[model samples]
Target: MNTPAALTLEAPAEHPFAPFVRILGKGKRGARNLTREEAREAMGMLLEDKVEDTQLGAFLMLLRHKEESAEEMAGFTEAVRERLTAPAIQVDIDWPTYAGKKRHLPWYLLAAKCLAQNGVRIFMHGGGAHTAGRLYSEQLLDALAIPLCRNWQSVNEALDTGNLAFMPLQDWAPHLQRMIDLRNTLGLRSPIHSLARILNPLGARCGLQSIFHPGYQSVHREASSLLGDNSIVIKGDGGEVEINPDTLSHLYGTTAGVGWDEEWPALSARRHVKPASLQPEHLLALWRGEVEDSYPQLALLSTMALALRGLGTPREQAFEQAQRFWDNRDTSI
Candidate 1:
């Protein structure tokens, strides 16, 4: 085991991250979960930037390979929940979106439009290239011509107007945001990539998350089983809200009870519809109105409506509502 390093008063100073680091490096499968206090302390150290890069690097890898326990994930989530920026329209919208990023742009845009149109008010938070999810959202938005929102005011206005609003993750949490650098430097994702997705910037109860990375799916599911009280989770193309047309997308959420019709779309049913494809850049250029709607849009409208419960609308009824929006020409968010 490695000796305990001197910890600064940042993320996990009070916790025994060094021991976990040793255990992880040794290739041990599952050892023990971190206590709530320990997880909170580690997050504090991380936020304060007091943890050494080597130790921090090990910390992320340990979680990646060793996998954090649900209890530990809960503790970490609680700490994040404590340190987030409150939503612009906090008490107004019961369901605020903790947005996920995926390479496909049309799906999230459609989901956001459907959710907003159906009154599942959301505050979509994101950033640039931190992971696959955010990178895709950024790329698509660049092509779509949609405005990139910078602060709470713009997001608040959009949500209030029954449309989606966004805030970049880097702007929300700089310390956590900095972890993305390790990806390019190290040439692989670390645990911070996992935690970043589960972040609750607005501290809202409902979050719409994507499960893209297969390795982290279980980690995410375990975490949700612990801290998820009000959230909507779906299997997206790469973890955003958009379901792949070639695969069935399931809602693996612990929040809101799933109605009969809201169950995950079967692979057979999902693969049944093969919408025509267009070049990514070409589709994006037209998505922004730089061109026109010549590309077939990826569909996630039904999955989205199913996740939010449609404000008490019956599952089937909610689906119908989603269908209409999907078919509508003004479906751009």
Candidate 2:
């Protein structure tokens, strides 16, 4: 008699992405972080939309649980850089502003404006307001009058005219932006949040990153070093790259492929109270000299100093130069 039809078919072939998931979820004794090459391949596939939804979720969560290593971060960044279709705009600084402000205003914007006014070519990129109750950079773009670039041509023009520009993550890397959008679905931030900070898409000479969580400063530092990136990572106010003038801040970074750490003293003796409300107009007022708040002034100066330091100025000289930039600002806003 002929064999039953149920036994005639073969099982489906395993997904190529399955091995990556298995490598991460192979139980306590077997699971480990992906090597740099493996991470690059995995991220390459993810960016190409070759990974399934289930596999993507699993890989993100697994990596999130274990926390991504420096190798993984560097490798993932490499994959992203390879896919970026950036123009030949010469950028002096790569500033990634992912975290919006909750308690304090984004004093860092003023710092960037100050630098831009003095001819530092700054490229700032960020995501939309994924979380509630926080004021994102894009929301204040109109008030700040900073150019919002939609494409590389616009970015090139903005930099040439104003020495600064802001681009949204979705405009350049939609796949990574989609992963970030899954914050609500995943109930936690995926590694994309951190990886995006290190992308420096135009290959700027200096990169600045801010991490809110403890211990991530070192991760960024090491990852930047591995990528040969001259970068600074700090636990800044509200998780943006604005320094808090009320408390001492620790900066972790790499310069010329060498890792180093520094401590910047607080500008104020006591911590400043959080603002009752965050007003986007206040940023304009502060820049135009209509407002004279000591807290924000110190914040702007210190934040600019940090950026200057990243641009290779010595610590003392950076602080002095930042003060000069603030004092000599156009204040025409």
Candidate 3:
């Protein structure tokens, strides 16, 4: 055989996160969403700090401006979960409370505590002070004397002692927390908020998430399905995983990889006003029987019912069970 001229095949150099940034920033005519795999790789680079800050900011804003797709959100969550040093725990529920409370007390904290008391091993994670004029979960939990765990071991230890444990995103996934903090600079929420809700670091059997925007309900549902997580995304109070008792809320999620959606009726007929002031003590005082409110009480039951249904309880039966738990809560505790 005649010796052919040697072919020179040079590999194209890959720039960290540049491919993804370009995919979203190709202008209106050419911009497109990243595939799931592309998103995963890009997010991996983000978590590893392999991308420049300029690229990170551009990528985030582009995604925000375009609106994140289900595949992209799933990929980001999966990438984060892959990097987590998750403790070996059979978590009954994964509750992400990053949205914080702007209008009301974090009654969801009380709901989680009630579920924990009822033997639901809840793994709650969130960030704090990321937004002005909002009451964060960590602050509210701290007010009630609930310890915020520093790491996986402490989380497991707390769950072993009591069915409840709250972990701040800063301790578990500092990289994502840093990105979340960029909200102040960016002046808008990013995809990080959506990804954090369904991170499910411990691979809990049930995930309870919330979205303030109604349009995100389908986005979260499809994303959870892509992650193979059995989760319920609800229009929660202040988007903090607690049901709004006054409004008919929509629910969406996956169960055993099958997608489902339902509309829940308003538990209370009267519309409740957002409080003039947020008192963290108000959460504890309500739980301790020193204070009482109809709205918070209904919110607690409805939210717990959703969590129960997420854990395989029958829909109507779950509500009944949740009501009993609420009625019998020991006020002194």
Candidate 4:
């Protein structure tokens, strides 16, 4: 009796995404950064949800550990941009606000409002509050009466009517928004945080990014250059695009495929103290001229100057024009 023939079983096949994980996570001597093409493919898989949960977590954390390079960021941005379906809307500036403010109110919102009131079309996007203890821009939109656009159609309408619109990442890129929401589970920020800032989905003429980390300003600048995007990267107040009034800020940027750097001097000689709590209502009050705070005033004007410079205004003229826009703003909103 040939006893039951010796049993044979087939081994499981390797996953398609395993190669990307190995490319990033292979041991110290073997691991290396992904090429731009490889990064584009990897990010495409992520956006398509073609990878497993375990693989997703590992890939994200490994990228976080290595800190994304400009090539990787550019490729990832390309993947995301490829998936965007919004038609071009003739926006003058592309503003990304991911880092919620902890040290001060979001003065940049008022600056954008001032510009919009003066005929500059601005497209702003953000991820809603995923991290606790910070005030997010979306939370204050109601106070400012800025329409929170829920779809591309609404965004187009808002831009046409008011020259400004704010959209949350969830509305446009739900997969990426889900990845950002994993901050609690992952216990660290992922490359998605940086990648989202450079998307510039509508192909706006100017992309403005604010990063808190020291070296990331260069990464953003170079990546924007690679993408042929005219962009400015700043280490702004609380990591939002709003310039701080009390300290000097460095602006790293790329224009027409060339990189440049600028130093913006402090607006005030004395450092302002952080507020105990951020009041959303104060934004409306300040816009309406009911509040008189020097800190927010300078913060708003200086932030607008950065954007104005991005729009081709000369440096001195940018500051003067920003102040004029603020003074001439229609405050009855």
Would you estimate the TM-scores of all the predictions? 0.74, 0.97, 0.93, 0.98
- Model 2 scores what on Cα lDDT? 0.92
- Candidate 2: 10-residue stretch with minimal lDDT: 2-11
lDDT of 4: 0.91
TM-score result, candidate 4: 0.98
Q: What does the lDDT read for residue 145 in candidate 4?
A: 75
Of the candidates numbered 2 and 4, which has the greater lDDT value?
2
lDDT of 2 by residue, 1-333 (tens): 988777577899999999999999999999999999999999999999999999999999999998999999999999999988997789999999998999988989989999999999999999999998988999988778899999999999999999999999999999999999999999998989999898999999899999889988899899999999899999999889999999999999898769999999888988888779987788888888887998999999999999899998998999999999999999885
Say which prediction, candidate 1 or candidate 4, comes out ahead on TM-score. 4
Model 1: how far residue 160 lies from native, Å: 2.2
Candidate 1's TM-score reads 0.74
lDDT of each candidate versus the true structure = 0.57, 0.92, 0.86, 0.91
The parts of candidate 2 lying over 4 Å away from their true place are 1-6
Candidate 4 lDDT tens digits, 144-204: 8788999999999999999999999999999999999999999998888888889999888
